[model samples]
Target chain A: MKGAVERVLRPEEIPQACDDLMKAGARLQMTYAWFPEPGQSVEVAYLAVTAPHEPFLFLRCSLPADSPHLQSLAPQIPLLGWYEREIQELCGVIFDGHPEPRPLVLHEGAHPSMPPLDPRYQPDEMMPFTSEPWDRPPVEGDDVQTLPFGPVRADVLESAQIFFYYIGEAILHCHPRLFFKHRGMEKRFEGTSPSLGVVLAERISGVDSIAHSLAYCQAIEAACGCEIPERARYLRTVLAELERLYNHLHYFGHLCHTTTLKVGEAQGKLLAEQSKQINGMLTGNRFLRGILKPGGLRRDLDLSTLPEMLNRLQPEITTYLRSMEETNSHLDRLITTGHLPLQTAYDQGATGPVKRASGIGRDLRGDHPYAAYDRLTMNIPVRTEGDAHARVQIRMEEIHESLSLIARAAKDIPEGPVSSEISYVSGGEGLGWCEGARGSTYYCVHLDDAGLLARVKIKSPSFSNWRVFPLTVHDTNMMDYAINEASFGLTMAGCDR
Target chain B: MPVWTLYGIRRGIATTSWPKKDGAVAQPEVLGLPRYHADRCRDNCRACADVCLPGALSFESCQTGERLALDYGKCIGCQLCTEACPNDALTKSNDWAFGVRNRDDLIWAEALKSPPAEEVTRKIQKYFGRSLHIRHVDAGSCNGCESELQALNNPYYNLHRLGIFFTPSPRFADLLLVTGPVTYAMQGPLRETYNAMPEPRWVMAMGTCAVSGGASGGGYSCGHGVEEFLPVDIYVPGCPPNPAAMIHALLLLLNRASQHVQGGQVAH
Candidate 1:
């Protein structure tokens, strides 16, 4: 509200405005929807982060129902390519002249003929995994051959198909087929009471449960016009930073693991285990689920062991990551592999550590500043290399910053009621966001008149960052694939959902 | 290089001595399955079942009266049923040691009896008694289960210490440990993986999602669980069962331990 200027434009005006806005230094966070009645019309929203000036530009427009289309922004905003395709598949809205309009979320034959968002759509009794809607983009070289990996992979947690058209050790072209983990998460959110939908939001991504729930709660809080207690915000800052600390430690460790660094992987797991255990001490669940409601978190800070756990966390991370940094054999594997240029990072809408490591001095925590970020110094470590090494370095730097932030917030959390009072009526729409470990995670909440969630569009940071995966693999040899993939730290579930 | 190696060595072994030592991972208020006391349920009570999102708790018409049915497989340990139960019929407990031999051990309030222990085929015990290799399939989990699964390898849990390891290849694996609600798209791959495992292979449902579809059960593009498609040897219940809980489940599978909490013990 402080710096953002909202505009309601017609379909015809969007291209001109978006074109001008991009030129004026506004970067697209995500383009999402709150469309209830599909055939009549649809309202598409563009959330742009206009840095060094107004924090955001909330541009929205309603396209006519008959055509159910708008001029494609895919060409201008290359990041919009997947976002547009997702809307087409998930919401059934076609963007006229979109570049790659083939379905994004669903495997081609995973669903029935009807679009998922259609009111009358019924799932087939037998959803056989038949054939893909489209083929992997063909690599046109005599020596190049296609080798497809996954939907199921070795030693990996989530599911996504990576088609590498390569020649021996040189990766020529890579195409990623995701949504093997899509459970129609947005579709699942519909019809559930907004109050109860927090469970759905919490499970959207396991590791980022707190941030996801906060984003959902904030949107509902915005609808209710409720201001949470100061104590609650500080508590949120503590847990969210804790989430970031463990995830980074896990990522850094896994990056080491790709090089067959046994001790590195074990240390990473050890630090991550500490984070999860501490989370269990603070909240009931290890994953920090069920900690938030629309008004505030369901529980308060467990201060009995807070000081002790924080003390343990800081040194473990410092000792482990610092030692790993000094290990040259490890550095030899990471430094030059998977280098991403700043231009490609911007053009593909790469986000989080991947973008930050490429010397893009932009972070939602420092730019838009949500939760308790404004009260913090918010030091974001930046690097120009944009390689596997930079990603690890950036994460290590943030872990140190996060540890201190948790300590400061724990000390400063005021004595006050954590929950708030809010009337839960419907016919409301609002945006909720957090600077999750991966990047800026956004949730667009729209509640219908009956207090039912009409639509909840979650744009996970992984959704944008996953776009850069294929591009990054081209930088390093094929042997570094595992290291490169883990370095990215993108979640298949979050991206697919 | 020597510095990191020395740091690791000086750090000493971080492994937990669980099964050897008394519980090391349990914390106060850490959630597991709800302990049900049928005697405490009020007459005509269906409150707990109503708030049960995954249909984990439900009532059925019986000649005696409406009877409560608790399916541990469907339960995500949300504790909503425990909170909603007016008579304290369902109470909170940290007794997460819920790895059982039979699928029927997961369902309760049906004549209030545990599944016969004989349901675990003797062949499985003979084949995997001392050592076991597991091939994990993420049928359709939220990645929460995977997080815990990864932790099993870390120094703290050190699953390998117990003679259990996660094999990347199914051909070499003896047990197929599956997580998630078993989405439709993954059904084919899941069946293929199970089929590839050599004979005497066992299926272990790792989380409530794979156990009984958890919260996202009965949705479009999802099967309620792996049990529907394949015979499961064990059921471990949690939103994503913790590392300790999962270890207990695996041990129980190999007959290394016994089930501790009895079904339907009415509180005094």
Candidate 2:
């Protein structure tokens, strides 16, 4: 919020502006559409970062509500394809000259009169689902057959359909039809008070509970020009790191399962459960929910017992990781599986661990430095392998980093007020970002006339990573598909939301 | 010996003897579903209902004027109501095991009595008392429910130890454990999974979402729980019910454990 610069541009100037930004080495972070005034005009904003630790640049273009049209930027910028497709489907904004423009969140049979995101739109009785084929790249060979995986996959996985063109073990092409879990999350945030909005944000992705709520709360805090107390900032950092620990451990366990290391998987999961138990002890909830509010924390946390608990769990995690590293079978499966090249990851706009693993050292914790992150010493883990092994190693290193961060935060936390009273500023817009367990989570909030939320656009890390994930899956074997996916630690809820 | 096996052996047994040994819990610090004390409610006090995001608590207009309708099935266990309550009507408790065979039992009502043990329970006990194969379908959960479901097979919970296993195929499954708010896209797949199951298969709604469409239920994409789409036999309601609660629900369906909750009240 402090360093973000905004510019209002003409609809015709978007393509040039995007080209200039791309030439300037700016990476597109988020693209979203909102109604400035009800039934009047549609405003589309593109947010990007030019350099590490630089202020975010926002380019806003307005289109008439009746005929909202914009020249497509997706052709030049591959990462903007999904964002453009989403805006096209949800806000009814047509991007002229877009390639392969298909419905992203909405499945084939869902036919709403106006876009479902439009305020005047009325939802039908039942949301229809049909197996209608979209434009998928043809893989035509007598041996190459198209196999449809699921909306209901095996085990306790999220609902998503994936199409794989394969010949024996070789994967020819990969297409993921996600968003089966789309709960209209952005629409649910409409007209809600900031406090209630936090509750909704926490549910957007249950795994990234702290990150989503933190970003949303930061956005509202920024809009209100509210600064939290020192203690609250440190505690926020602590909670986020705790979330990272559990998530990474869980991811490690799942990755092990995919590699067929049953014992390793069990051990990793048991450690994760212990980490969650520690979280439950710190906060009353296991998922670290119900504590984050707009101003700061809902309640003051007790850190007297945190250091000892974290210290005890830290050694177990070290041993677990060391053991995992030592497992040749596990290491062999991950070493070169799901190889995503550096150029592909960069071009596709990968974020969080995915980008970090691809040698991009752009961690929001160090670059942006929100919530006591600036106060602490930040050491980012980066790998250039751009494979499953690199991703796993990144998470492993991050777990250690998170533990150290929490320890340092707990030790140096200053005693003060945890929260500050927020005065809602009508028509205030703010953008907030945080480095989540998976990736950098962004939230841009616009307040309505009455100082309530008008439109909340969430750029979940998974939304970016999911877009970039299929790139790694292509040309990969069928045997390592699940392993590759597990190593990435992608969640459908985050993507769908 | 393999390093993993040795490492596991060194850690010793971490599994809790819950439902097997009395007073044993998975996590002691974690708070469960909010307990509603109807007698302590003040007249015209809708503090709990106002903050209830999922409409778990609401004032229902009954014959005797408006009465507070409390449904644990829709509760995500956020405990906002307990904090907002001026009087101690809604209190926080460790009532994590809220699994019930009867759907109506989750809705709170004064003097609501539990019906006698059904003949169906005995039949289920006869069929799946020893070993139960479960096929889980994630309707449209936030992966919170999936996280907990995955925890059931972990070293601590060890669901397979209790003879309850998550089978990959529905053909061999004795129970279809469904989670999430039953999103529209998932209804077809869910029905197909249920239909594919063998005869005498039971449906257990695993979380608040599956029970009564947690927070995202009745939204544009998803319906209110699995009950709307399928005949649910057991309703376990937590935001994402802890691993222990899921085990209790499975055991309850098999008539291995007695129902602890009746009319949303935890029996001592």
Candidate 3:
């Protein structure tokens, strides 16, 4: 409870404050900029907090409307490099000292030419950008060999350009260039209604629809000071847990499938299918869409269906676990592959299963405790080995934890209205964070008088975790890429959006 | 090995004689448009219209000079409307066979017409007798569709038991499952996939993004629709259509009763 630390600081003092905070043993959580209007100017805020603690210290900085430029913090905090580049690309704010300042989320010709966050920018003036002359400087030494994997590759479904440089069997350097599936989601939300913004958020990532929607809805509700019913919170938790259960199962299955482990693949598929069935039964849609509203849930869970779900899940999950246990060869392959050391994970700010596997017991559900998570008795699984096998083990254990959470939530659900009526007032800004299946998904929304969304900035788990992906694949082969990617369960759509 | 074979044999025949009959097993909730009950309506809400991703819902009140119209083609079946409807006027139906021959027929302007009570029993009995063979193509999808498509093979769903087996080579396929909005690059491959399939093969367009380019279609690289490049038999609308809905669509295509699948057949 450091009251003085909670106060926001001015722009010029941010770098020093960040350094002091880092020296004080505070983790450099994240940094982002908020623009009141595009091209008018921007106020940048850097968030720093110690691990296993709440009440983050926020340092604020402002830039002139005409010249949206700020001093780069990358030299001080190494993690700020990617965040700075993203801020520059999205908000048109120049981190003057940034090493690389290319577009992170927008394609070559898709935008209004100048920068996306500028309010003066019009849709008609937008042009597409191409990636023609991105050829890097040639290497001299014999040991340094450059390998270009994609823009087009076998495993990659979306478009991305990655260049991997290797020195003998070890990867010396790797650079990722993305923005292939940029749909201008943030720009599209500018003039739309608030309700429509919810849809936009859900579509940010097709797979993590509920998580994105929940984060967006929470932000909206907070901005409007709306209180959701008890049932809605319970429902939200159920949907989130279901998503986690399915995602982890699917990820495990993908890992197995990538390794060509037949029995493990089959077992993973069966578990994932069971999760899907539960999802379909609860909501008419398998992905659990339409259930989350700004103020509450769309509908109440049908009581009769609960018993059926229990009956189906209990026996099925048990059998699935047994089958997975029988497949030891698959487990052996994943054991020490794609290792990320504990120190590296901490330095890179890795979250979700990646962090937990590295023995950092930081789960937003347990640590932050939002929605119905506080009431539920949950176990946060951690493994000392930060390898693919540890990640697999964490996922498997979490599935059981999710089952328990779901069972408990279903059993203890209170009787109440599924939703509460919500209306908007003027000049409100609110932040909401939800522990998505992957990691902490944060949403900040500023609303106008009409209760419509004015501006929104979303930071998905993938944005934070993508920083560590290439780092972990330092010595791994190209063939192990899918296994490495699947183990992390990072969504390019979420990051790109 | 012999014991495993014996176990396989003891499990009996898992294949369903779909289309000839109906599927023996059904997903608990099949995909379709929502049903509205005007009688139970308190018309103060436009939440459904607001939450609809594709501008599918429109409402008008006569007394208050407003009217509500729903465009089935635009609906992704996200069901946010069902959550917002306080009057219990909207409910999700399991009847996924919503495809139509005419564009006008695809619209669900009025409340759903219920089948006769006696026919429900007959339909259930018939469902157990149908069998279907399917072929799936990865037509520039984000692989979300492919993931869900594979899940249909899992033990819980076990689409194979419903006579739904995905054929690798299209020559033996009864239906062609296309997933994605047909990207410019994949346009050739999509046509190749369709052309490779045998005669009397039906094309089932899965996902809203694929059906009418839900979001990705408007891009320069994306094709207008799967039908623009290939002859589609049935349209299963969703961003990435749920596996249950996918199964239902396959079943409907197998029924050979859908006019949408029957009409608009170009000789490949």
Candidate 4:
């Protein structure tokens, strides 16, 4: 509430408020439920944001502890569908008149009566695991067939099942059931010191470690009203860009692998490994974990050698990207594959490169300007094709921009203390956000009376994009499914968590 | 295609002769598992244990009053313990090659000592004949393990050069490599994959989560590690063990390399 403009409204006013916010050119950032007081009342918070550099608008409504019910906003705001379903299952809140209000995170094996997130529920009271038959949607046609892909897919990949209904190489509908990797990450942050909360945040999505921890630290810092050193801010920018470079490179390689470009895949992956080596050299960790804390950084890092290393790797990466762009065989498969219309992308709440590729130029780095991004200047690339090729192009251009940002930060960074003492304040709440490699990641922190974390709600970029992914696969051919998926670079761990 | 060939050739041979030669180049300026010196530890000090979020280091009441129990399998290599220690008991090192054949080999106890030195003979080579196929399963990892696992096939590592391939089917796999904390939803699928594999198959836990549930273990949704539901033959314990460490672990399983860490101490 301290960092956000807080307002209290009744359950019935939620729909009209969301409509008004959308009319004012604001979008739904996140919607989550938490127990303000353990067993007394259930509070639902909705966060909305307007264009560039606007503070978040927080809307709250209370429900009775005995029977928590709310008018479903998913009918109007399509983005709230999954969030409301998750809240209904995990927090035991009922959304009246909701369409398709089935189980989201918990399958049938979980305890039927007890909500795990409810403060009154006990962990030992969980029911035993029992196999349940999956119910498939009835579709009638001559060539219609349902194919269940995986909880365990081929190659080294995360676990999530995908249901594809198709006819002779053409897909009719696609349904992805994720959260098989949900380790209850947000629940794991409860009752822990905000310092330890950063550690848990880093593990939320391993590839987005710096972005997740940075957002978590900024939340704690904002709650305490502490300003970190200038040097730490610049170093944080460098680390975040390094993460972006490796991730985009990996995305490029995986895209190549999907397109059957063997040479291109090897070249792209080699460049990614080199970028990781640079991360290890500068931060002492390949994934750039454990360097960030609540206040600032745990220790000062020596980054004098970063610019030189980046300078050496830039040309190889450039040539590799150029070669991939020139290859017609690779470009042919991606040009018109998995086309997502502009209106559908915006309506489904797409973010990051996916949204940008569909001609929505919304980037939190240029808009919100967190972690020293305000000081650095870079162009946000946008493509109007709304296809796999456009998405790949956005990432390629982003890799070039990330390299320049890292080099500039390394050169202009000042020498000073990297951290400050964090004095935790009770009953303080703050929201922090960062534009990670994938998209914008938001972390909202609420400290309890003992100054420990009561609730930490993480709205990952993948959660939005994963919801938008199936929209593109509705009528696409099965041959291009893997390529379309590779271009999106969606991580199940990030979305499931 | 010709230009691509030229580009790759210009870069030259980037692969490292790791298992045959010293492979320090693979992990430069990187911090590995913290080395715990038993003699340097002070009595009744909980400095390291208090900050360990994953319970990798804890003070247990032993027969001799109190002792620090160190388990590399549970360590995430975050360097928090090394910074929290008042004494010089825990220090940072560059020994990234930590792959063991036994789960207990990763734990440090006063009564524990290094087992007999193993011969570097290729014991399992004849059984598998030409090459080894691996079927990787993600129990509930953070995706860091999969990231590093993908790098094994890169030009620098070129995992295929070592006669190991990641097959798409478990039926053709000789070893099952697992990552993550074995979340509840994945428990059944992981078992199904293992059951589908051929006989004489070995399992390798590739990360701290798969070894002893690094950060998100024991939560309401996930268990501690794969050992709870599956038998593991090797434990390579880093937050997400680096690409080179995974190669060492695979070779150690094949008896091509000796165990590097015993009872949480680097043998070298």
TM-score of each model, in listed order = 0.95, 0.98, 0.80, 0.97
TM-score attained by model 2: 0.98
| Model 2 alpha-carbon drift over 4 Å, by segment | A1-3, A123-135, B62-65, B114-117
Compose the digit string of candidate 3's lDDT tens values, residues B55-156. 667775667666666555556666667767777767665544444423344455444333313342244236434665666664445445766777777655
| Candidate 2 pairs with clashing backbones | A352-A439
TM-score computed on alpha carbons, candidate 4: 0.97
> Which residue runs does candidate 4 get wrong by more than 4 Å?
A122-127, B111-123
Tens-digit lDDT string for candidate 1 (A385-421): 9998998888888888888898888887788888888
Against the true structure, candidate 3 reaches a TM-score of 0.80
* DockQ result, candidate 2: 0.67
Label model 4 with its docking quality class: medium
Runs in model 1 lying further than 4 Å from the true structure: A1-5, A52-55, A64-66, A111-113, A119-129, A132-134, B26-29, B43-47, B63-67, B119-121, B261-268
Clashing pairs in 1: A40-A65
- Which scores greater on TM-score, model 1 or model 3? 1
- The CAPRI-style docking tier of model 1 reads medium
- Candidate 4 per-residue lDDT over residues B143-243, each given as its tens digit: 99999999999988999988999999999999999999898888899999999998878899989999988998876788888999988888889987888
Interface RMSD for candidate 4 relative to the native interface: 1.7
Candidate 2: residue B18 lDDT (0-100): 78
State the lDDT of candidate 2 residue by residue for A142-225, as single tens digits.
988889998778887888889999988899899998988888878877777777888889998898999999999999988889
Query: What is the DockQ for all candidates, taken in turn?
Result: 0.56, 0.67, 0.19, 0.70
Question: C-alpha displacement of B40 in model 4, angstroms?
Answer: 1.8
